[model samples]
Target: MENVEQEFLSVIREYERVIYKVCYLYTTPNATLNDLYQEVVLNIWKAFPKFRRECKISTWIYRIALNTCISFIRKEKNIPEIVTLTQEADRSEEDDETQAMLQQLYRMINRLGQLEKSIILLYLEEKSYEDISEITGLTVTNVATKLNRIKDKLKKMNKED
Candidate 1:
């Protein structure tokens, strides 16, 4: 039991950033982000024992985190919280431009439907089509189709802005 607990802690420590990134992208409010992060952690711990070595640990983490975020968002639909893109206060000038672009991108992402948001998030994270497909339960061809359509949607949205 102690060994399992320790292993869980180690896994959480290694993948904390990835989990946090998923939570951040899904949620805007700091409080909600924290809540979602905790939920993801709890789910990870609960599911750890059943984690077969079939997929990479990171892939498993992504699947769990994304599912938690999506479910939470669905449940919180009535709350109507204000969503923001960036949370950081202090930033270097160089970072400002990149941050601004990211903020704009996230703004667009926020408008996307839940499934599209997941696909784009995976793509932004540099996941390969196969990895995204596995994580999302979409076929590789479906993932490719969705990504292409999402790109076109973003392009149109940007042009309209």
Candidate 2:
């Protein structure tokens, strides 16, 4: 038990940022973000004992975090927008600008239907088509086609502004 606890702590220490980002991506408002973050951490702790290193630890962490976030988002009657970014190693002014764009993108994404929002979130994570397909249970071609359509939609929205 102690060993598992230690291992879990170590793994979390390495991946806490990913967990926090996913929660924030699934929630809006700081309070809801915090609540979801705690929930994700709790879920990870609960599921840690059963952890098997079948795939990359980060991938497993993402799967669990995304699923928990998705579930929480579904239960809410009025879901709020989520903003997320993959932290680049280089944190510069350009990165800051890109982050701002991501926030704006989230606002636009909020207007989309629930499934479209989910697909966009995964796409923004820069997941490969196969990864998105695997995570979303959608066919790779479907994921690609949907993403292409969503990009055009977003572009049209941007142009209208």
Per-residue accuracy of model 1 over 83-124 as CA lDDT, tens digit each: 576553234554878888777887788788889989998898
Task: State residue 149's C-alpha deviation in candidate 2, in Å.
Answer: 1.8
RMSD of each: 2.2, 3.6
Sliding window of 10 residues with minimal summed lDDT for model 1: 85-94
Error of 2 at 122 (Å): 3.3
> Candidates' lDDT values, in order?
0.86, 0.73
Off by over 4 Å in 2: 29-31, 79-92, 95-100
> In each prediction, how many residue pairs overlap at the backbone (N, C-alpha, C within less than 3 A)?
0, 0
Question: Tens digit of lDDT per residue, candidate 2, span 1-112?
Answer: 8988898889889988778766765665533767887888889899887777775677677777878877887777474644444443234656677777766676677666
- Residue 58 Cα positional deviation in candidate 1, in Å, after optimal superposition: 0.8
Best by TM-score: 1
